[model samples]
Target: MLPKHDVCGEPLYTPKIIFKEQGETKYETTDPYVWCRKCKKYVEVEVTQK
Candidate 1:
């Protein structure tokens, strides 16, 4: 999912690559939390493929 601003209306930190899996197919997963500088905490989010 594309990163979006936090609830405080501040831009979130860039999504971090958590891991990469390789098997029949190769895909990388990103961290579910979007860090907010103003909030000083993480906002949970779900990543999905369009």
Candidate 2:
């Protein structure tokens, strides 16, 4: 999960999963978005794999 703020430090909420990709390796990539109350829209977020 990313920080509580977006690029411009706007509060984020309701993380929604957009899609998932399977790579050749064991790691799986996922794309998600969060609702930005300030912008009144959804913004992409970075997810770190462990």
Candidate 3:
């Protein structure tokens, strides 16, 4: 039988809004809110220092 992903593997989820930015590129967060996983949103990818 096939194994359950959420139990044996990684849980399915969405992306988040909060992310990084760099020069002209953007790196959106894959899980910012990290609430229900589905609440996660995403923008363009970026790069910067905290």
lDDT of 3 by residue, 1-50 (tens): 22113323434333345658888888865443222333243322222225
Question: In model 2, which residue pairs have backbone atoms overlapping below 3 Å?
Answer: none
lDDT of each: 0.70, 0.61, 0.38
lDDT of 1 by residue, 1-50 (tens): 34666476776666678656677676778787877778888898666555
**Which residue segments of model 3 deviate by more than 4 Å?**
1-15, 36-50
- RMSD to native for every prediction? 3.5, 5.0, 10.2
lDDT, model 1, position 38: 80
- Using TM-score as the measure, which candidate wins? 1
Ranking by TM-score: 1, 2, 3
lDDT of 1: 0.70
User: Against the true structure, what is each candidate's TM-score?
Assistant: 0.55, 0.46, 0.27
Residue 17 CA error for candidate 1 (Å)?
A: 1.3
> What TM-score does candidate 2 reach?
0.46
Candidate 1 clashes between residue pairs 3 or more apart in a chain or in different chains: none
